[model samples]
Target: MSILVFVEQRDARVRSIVREVLGEASRLAAVLGGPVVGVCPAASDPGLATLGDAGAERVLLAAHEAFARYDAAGYTLAVVAAIEAVKPQVVLFGASAMGRDLAPRVAARLGVGLATDCTALAADGGRLTATRPVFAGKAIQKLAFPRVPALASLRPKVFAPAAASGRTATVEPLTVGFDPAAARAKVVRMAAAAGARVDLTEADVIVSGGRGLQDAGNFRLIEELAEALGAAVGASRAVVDAGWRPHSEQVGQTGKTVSPKLYVAVGISGAIQHLAGMSSSRCIVAINKDPEAPIFKVADYGVVGRFEEVVPALIEAVKQLNAQV
Candidate 1:
């Protein structure tokens, strides 16, 4: 038995989340007693030998022309084929945009239970349990799998990537019978966002603003702070709804969930919906005029002041620190 990880790729390169999944799967495999395997669907080989350092004992490459772009039907077939071939004890997928789409498809196709957005996993007595946030992050739930080959999708950036061990995994080719007609939908083209910053989900550090900024034009303060800290810019739902920020930068229950190493909240009132997305960050720094703002409750550090004054001082401090380094 083995733990199988669905290795996602882009532009013929492996995604960072795959390494995190593989690392976590390796840890679980140690407790569950098995090897960790990677199942990758790509148009071409992504040179995955380095994954061995991240604890992939072996990688199954499911290469096909249909895999050039993420066709839901084709990817579902590839993952199903890999599962059938490997007969893994557990299957892990990153809870990213692609994984969120693909995981449920595979689960429905195989008629198995699926857990999405899992933040933690544990193995006991050769059994696996998954932990996830529920009720808009107000409660936590632990789930157990009654069936074998437990399926789960892990939240990105929640788990630490495995340290390199100078080991190499053996890559093997896996063939899947893909039918063109089965693909009901196809991605003809993708338009990238103009001047896109770091993906919020994958960013190590994030600086977010909310309605407390007073006006849309004031977002420049948030951007300057993010730039100074080399972090991604995020916005509260109120800001997005007000058109002060794009929906892509929104972080909350209705927006994107982020678990960055450091999360800076400026002028955000910390609505429950907003806290749902970012409460898991390793370090949270909140700056708000109201000392009683809900955001301060979860923040590791709280600064009570208006953003207009607090933000500029913080940005200057960051710049001076960067200069010193």
Candidate 2:
């Protein structure tokens, strides 16, 4: 059987996470010597054909009025239909909020085992083995499912996105008799956050701040540095709780878990809950005045100085690096 990957989207646009999942799915398919298929719930997206570059041999798009907006129930139904059509041995999803909600429902409907938030995956002898964090990132658990198709959700940014191979793929339309009323939930309207920044989960670089920034006004330093690095802006729970930043920007256990290529923590004391969220980041840089801050312990590099002094210098350095490039 082949491998399948769910294509994630937002506001009539394909999300970067889709590429990440496809990259991983392609590798898993190689291990099993199987083909990779891409599945998406869209309202006639021409971009579906481009999935081939990421390693999909065929792309399936489920188009319907109910798909115009995201309703978990309708989406689940469409995905189930696609899964039944493909009959894949392994199905992969990027562990975004939507994927986290959809994977279990899809698994239950199909009567198969589902693994969530897998950081590592491997296919051995046509069997699937998944490594995931347990006890709030304190322990690791390896899971295997041999009897049925393996449904797994991968952590965002843990796997690098595969480059386009310039191969063309065939696009197929999936017919689903979608009923709008059948969906228990329907999104009426979608509003963006106050200021749109890079998507944290998909960003390669993120600059996160905490209460150490002193006040909301001081966050300018963080923003400036983010702009220099073309990074997303994130916050610790304390910053969110204090109303200095929105919950969307918060990066901690209670907020959003992000594993970017580079994570920069400014004036944030690392709490266990916060570490649980960003500990898997490929490279972590901590900047705080206190040398004893908890964030320094896990940081791949630490700066012992105030963010005000450090941020300006860092921003300038990034500018020079960009100019040289």
TM-score of each: 0.96, 0.92
After TM-score superposition, the amount by which residue 253's alpha carbon in candidate 1 deviates from its true location, in angstroms, is 1.7
Best model number under lDDT: 1
> Which runs of model 1 end up more than 4 angstroms from their true locations?
193-196
> lDDT, candidate 1, residue 147?
88
TM-score of 1: 0.96
Off by over 4 Å in 2: 193-195
Q: Where is the poorest 10-residue window by lDDT in model 2?
A: 189-198
Candidate 2 global lDDT: 0.86
Candidate 2, residue 171: how far the Cα is off, in Å: 1.4
Could you give me the TM-score of model 2 versus the true structure?
0.92
Summarize candidate 2's per-residue lDDT along 98-211 as a digit string, tens digits. Answer: 899999999988888999999999988879999998765767899999557799999887876778999877888888877887666778775765226677877889999998
